[model samples]
Target: MEMRAPEEIEIGQDITPPILPLAFTLSDSSLHSHCSSCFHPLNPKIPKPKPNNSHNPVPIPCNSHCNSSLLYCSHHCRHADADLHVSSGECHLFLQSDTSTWPSELSQLRLALRLFLCFQKLGFLSPEFLVSGRIGGLMSNREKFDIPGRIREGGRIMCLARRMRDGRFGNVVGESATDEMVLCLVLTNAVEVQVSEGRTIGVAVYGPGFSWFNHSCSPNASYRFSLTGFIGEPGSLEPGFRVTPCGEEGTFKAWNGDEDKLTNGSCKYGPKVMIRSIKSIKKGEEVCVAYADLLHPKMLRQSELWEKYRFVCCCDRCNSSPLTYVDRILQQNAANHSTCLDLDHSLCVEEAYRELTDCLDQAITEYMSSGNPESCCEMLEKMLIESSKTEQSQPLEPSPSNFKLHPLHHLSLNSYMTLASAYRIRALDSDSDKDNQLEAFELSRAGAAYSLLLAGATHHLFSSDSSLIAPAAHFWISAGESLMGLVKSSKWSSIIKKSSGFNLSSLLTQRSGKCLLLTELELGFVLRDGFDVVCKGFLACISRISPKVWPFLVHGLPYLKDINDPLDFSWLGMTARHEAQALIGGCECEGVAYIEEETIWKGLVLFALHCLLYGGYLTSVCYGPHCYLIGHVRNLLYGGEGSSLSENVENIC
Candidate 1:
């Protein structure tokens, strides 16, 4: 049953026994009835006759004799002896002195009567009072009366009427006599009923300002009802239970499974019940919940718990060093971000296959080096899947029906290309059969790599710059030509797509501008070599194709001054001189061709010096005169002596 406030309450009449008049002798030697402690008159002052024995001891008034001695009849003496009456340490009343201080004897009596009513409400007292001998010449009664109404009106009664009954009143009489009186009254008025079944035990719903309870993560109490055992699975509840009433609802649950498991259980309190740390707390530290999970991280916990609850936490877990805390977090972050490797790197494959496989492995490793571990693992797994498909195809035997290149085919192709280039250069200088076979295999591998690179380049063309396409085209053409020179016809047709399908026209057009510039530079060297080979005459081919190649030659002449190789420059210089003289003889009869003439003359001078810098080989027909012409051209290009051009020319010479 729900505990509710009593609508009405009754107090029985005082059952105190009548005080027997004491015959006492005062200092005057007169016999009189008086209080033993206060020495006050025992009878009311209304009309009692004086005692006949004038020689008896004189009676002293209790009011006049009451002093600092605790034995006196003052309320202070009752307070001093309060500790003796309580069994559980000091009474709550003594601790709450400011609220318990009574303004008068009547007020003190009223509080005591309230306490008696509370005990009666709790069923700790009988309805009838067990009175004893009384003092102050009064008889006391504890029979039934209107307890609630009398208490309500007791505050207005004067001293005579209040003192006429028991010396106790029924109303609080101090400034501090506010809600505590009402709270006590309410508590004492409610009847406690017991429930036998259900998850909930007893619940106390406090009004506003009653949520000041603190929390303990390892709580001291579990919820229990008055009649039933603690509400939980069997064995969860322990005997001899006592609740601290100081923690949060969750805190209680943390201690008991039944309470802990319920989502919207009866225990619904405010954030005040949350327990927060007052200092830094480290991970893995035993966390103590103040108001249960009231406060979270220490930074927030300290500000909130102190500001709201006014308590500082000194728990050991809340005092972790900052450096240690940071290091622990960083370690955790690293662990959470690591990738797991599954494939064994020791697996065997042919040399070409291994090179490609290694490239794929390196790419996978780099991609997974930073980020979430699960993502890195996924990426590496994909790489391994691709590696497995392509690691077996490079041997001399043909592949089976199930064979396929790895999905990470691009990375493998790039690796193959790099290795083939290295082998090709190596084979050019080595004479061993092993080297020759290796070079042949490398050329075939390079052809395959170029095919793969071209496919990727085609896919990237729309998204990337046109310049990127040139490398793919150049490498493919070079590799195809190399494979045609080395491999059998059957293999060449398979690896090299027919030149018809490939857009050679588009490729050549795209390369024309850059090719023209390169050829012009190469031609200047070929001329100094006296046109010994068609390769050296590559510039003449450019000039035959179009006169537009002439401008690139003029632009490249200034850069030739810094060339370090005398032989290379000398070859280039002779080629340039021949080309210039040919252009001059063709255009000399037309005065309108002077602009072309000046460009031809500059190319000639640049080429002549290039030839003279090295040991110029001479023909018998024009040997002496050629040397004289070379010397004359060098002096003119360098400017008169002691000038910047002469200085540069001298440095080169």
Candidate 2:
């Protein structure tokens, strides 16, 4: 829809317009065409002569440019303009001039300034006419006319004058003069004259017509100054009445017949307007703005607005009570503390951590009471460090099953790893029962957790269909390093070896061997490029202690050929093949040297080869060739040019 223009005044039947132009002039002498007091064009018949006074009147020169339509002489003009006689109750005939009293001339001067300023601010004055009149009766004339009656009577006269000009009054009979008419009358009563800066020339006369706009602390219509003219609506200016509609029937109707006449039957109206959030209004409710500057905090804002506006606001922020304030303060403090910590000052870091711990405790209590798991989770992370430390030191025997681990201990792999390192460090420092037990417990737990992570991680690396094999392989390598640390730690070795024995043969028969073997396989795949060096070192150490467990080495060969997973498979396969060759080569040479030339050495060799192939004799044989040597015999068996027996016999010394 197109927006309407400003400067549009609605002239209803009861609406009244100002009859006199909002302009006037001042003079030094009893001017001819000028008013006796203001020195504008005065009505010739109604001469405002000076009152009799004991003091001699001072004579002042009149402006030469003024018209010479003489009523009063230059001497009278001078006496009337002088400050001495104008006060002293002697200027009654001169339109109530009392210069000695500040109210008399001072009020008029203020009124004139206001009118000039208004013209500067707003573009035009209302077109409706008003009658010239006086404000409150003079103290001397109070007994002559009833004060209230004069005010009421004067209001009625102005209303009639306005209605006559408008031609008709609308509906709603028996009402008082509208606010517009009342304003015009009030202006006439408070009219005054003013002089320019040097007092050499007169500027204009003005009145208090707009003063009836009232003083609302939370007023809706705001005034703004304009140099050109008033621009109404959003953009351009136009001619029409700027009426704000009322929702109720006859709610704005005039109270009296005189008022109705003044406004030409239009409803009583004032500058005080309402701005509502909705289009419709509710009964008995007064429209309002917040009355406070938007920048202030809620508490301060409400207090100031309530004191000045005399109404309590019910906004959501205002009604939130003290809890909101507390929460806001805490949040602000937290933000500030965090910023301080970011500077990396040690003191600030400690302080921030302490404050965060306190906040977490409070938040946890609140969240638990409210039964909000999400909020609880948020707080749990904040207190994770302290919680982990406390739980780790607590005795394990008496702990409840559900609460056996701290939240971090249960959830984060990092926490488990850290705990394991701490225990290992402490065990190295002290050999006490407490340290030993704690170390063993933590290491065992860490090992278990690492094992689970490694399984998931390695599966992703070695799975035939795995898409993220490269990245998974990288993760598996790192995980293997962590497990290797656990495997080689003095505390772990002491705990395991002391509890059991240094029997690789026996261990290979148990679940522990499978776990170790799987760990080795995964590590080999992860560190394929370094597998020969790492696996050779490991095997060499195991070989010196337990030579009987060589078959397990042979069993790992198939995994080398068939495993195409992206992890370091090549290095692992090559290392396995190299170890098999070494073991089989040792068996062939030794058996040929020790056995009699024909005493079934071939069967024994073949049996050793079979044992190497199947891993069945790994824990049984005490003195045998390296298990890897069997792979060479098998290769020879397959690659021999002639019969296997013929080639074997030729090779025998």
Query: Which candidate ranks first by lDDT, i.e. highest?
Result: 2
What is the C-alpha lDDT profile of model 2 across 1-653, one tens digit per residue? Answer: 00111233211111112212233223334244443332333444533434663121222333322232222223544444333222211222232222233313322332233332233233322332212122211011222222444334433333332343345444322332332333333233332222211122232222222222222222222211111111122553222223222322222222121322212111111011111121122332332223343223344455664443333556544566542322122122211212233334445534654554465556546654674533443454434433332322223332111112122111222332233333333334443465475554344333323332322323222232122222222233333333333333443455345424322122222222212322232221222323234323332322231222122111222211121221222221111112322221122222322223232222222222222222211101110112122223333233333233221222211
User: What tens-digit string does per-residue lDDT give for candidate 1 at 545-648?
Assistant: 22321232223222111222211112211111223223211211111122453333223222222222211111111111122322332233233332222211
Models 1 onward score TM values of 0.15, 0.18
Off by over 4 Å in 2: 1-236, 239-251, 254-290, 315-653
* Model 1 CA lDDT for position 546: 21
Q: What's the true lDDT of residue 496 in model 2?
A: 42
- Quote model 2's TM-score: 0.18
Question: How close to the true structure is residue 651 of candidate 1, measured as C-alpha lDDT?
Answer: 11
* Candidate 2 whole-model C-alpha lDDT, 0 to 1: 0.28
> Which candidate comes out best when scored by TM-score?
2
